[model samples]
Target: MPHRSSTLNRRLVRYAFATLFAALSTQAAWAASFDCGQAKQPDERAICASRQLSEMDVEMAVRYDTLTGLVAMGTRGDMQDEQRAWLHERAACRGDRRCLRASYTKRIDTLKREYDQLKSRGPF
Candidate 1:
């Protein structure tokens, strides 16, 4: 009975790990925030085509969303406005991978700095 229970537990653990791996593999394989199939703009198409750009877009989006949630309403509004402006800047890059990479790097840096500032302000 103990042997059977242990074997069952091991199987459960393996199944859990396999599930997690599949989900992560799928995400990593296509990490863009937007649907690659529906990608219309040249910039969007470039992001979907390149693994690195897709990952960066996902990272930047996560950071922006998280930071916006944490900040005050006024700050959140400003962030949203800035984000709209930044999208235009990104769109301007079009199919230029180097430009897109630089744009994502800059935006990610800005978000990280803001996050650090917010973290420094509290025990929460």
Candidate 2:
């Protein structure tokens, strides 16, 4: 009767929220730093194609951006150079998933170490 209708409405609302959350999570998981629609390079295309690589790209971009913001001007320049070098190295992989994964892993680790060092030196 009325109680059943109320219960059904509550369940419907919960289901809708759950569906929305799941969709957002899935979209976020595949979101990389660069635009997939215009991806031209083989490496870029491969990253766009793979969920795992896309997630790693997002992680690397976030860490790199966060670190760049926190570091001094000179340090930031050096970090940018390092990132450029890493990008070249990653591009050399040219759609090789294993190589791309390894490169991302190494770059992420390096960024993390740098972040930890900055933390140790800072009250800023």
Candidate 3:
């Protein structure tokens, strides 16, 4: 009876780990699918676009935090211009949330164009 119980316990542990691994793998796949440029299906494209918007929101928030930090550090003149440009780019990339929610492809394209323009303008 003890031997049978031990075997069952081991099996249960194995099953638990397997379940956890599967869940993690699925999450990773979902994240990978959320890259707007990598979607192959229409549904996937929409999902990717939504994910991109969410990511842009997070990025903008981070840029705002950085701007605040720079201000705290007494950034001035050209430094201020650079930081302001960075903030502008972040805001542009964020685009219109309503439009993004209504149409993912257009919003993604807008973001990509804004990002490219920012990159061409040099670093902040």
Q: Write the per-residue lDDT of candidate 2 for residues 1-124, one digit (tens) a residue.
A: 9999999999999999999789667765586899888899999999999999998999999999999999889999999999999999999999999999999999999999999999999697
**CA shift of 100, model 1, Å:** 0.3
**Inter-residue clash pairs, candidate 3:** none
> Best-fitting candidate, measured by lDDT?
2
In terms of lDDT, the poorest run of 10 residues in model 1 is 23-32
**lDDT on C-alpha atoms for all candidate structures:** 0.93, 0.94, 0.51
| TM-score of every prediction relative to native | 0.83, 0.79, 0.25
1-124 per-residue lDDT for model 1 (tens digits): 9999999999999999999889778845565987888899999999998989998999999999989998899999999999999999999999999999999999999999999999999977
- What does candidate 3's lDDT look like per residue over 1-124, in tens digits? 9999999999999999999789666634335323546656444444444555545444544544444444335443544565456545434434455544444344345445545655576776
- Candidate 3: misplaced stretches above 4 Å? 28-124
Residue 37 displacement (Å), model 1: 1.6
What is candidate 3's CA lDDT for residue 39?
Answer: 59
lDDT of 3: 0.51
Question: What's model 1's lDDT at 59?
Answer: 97
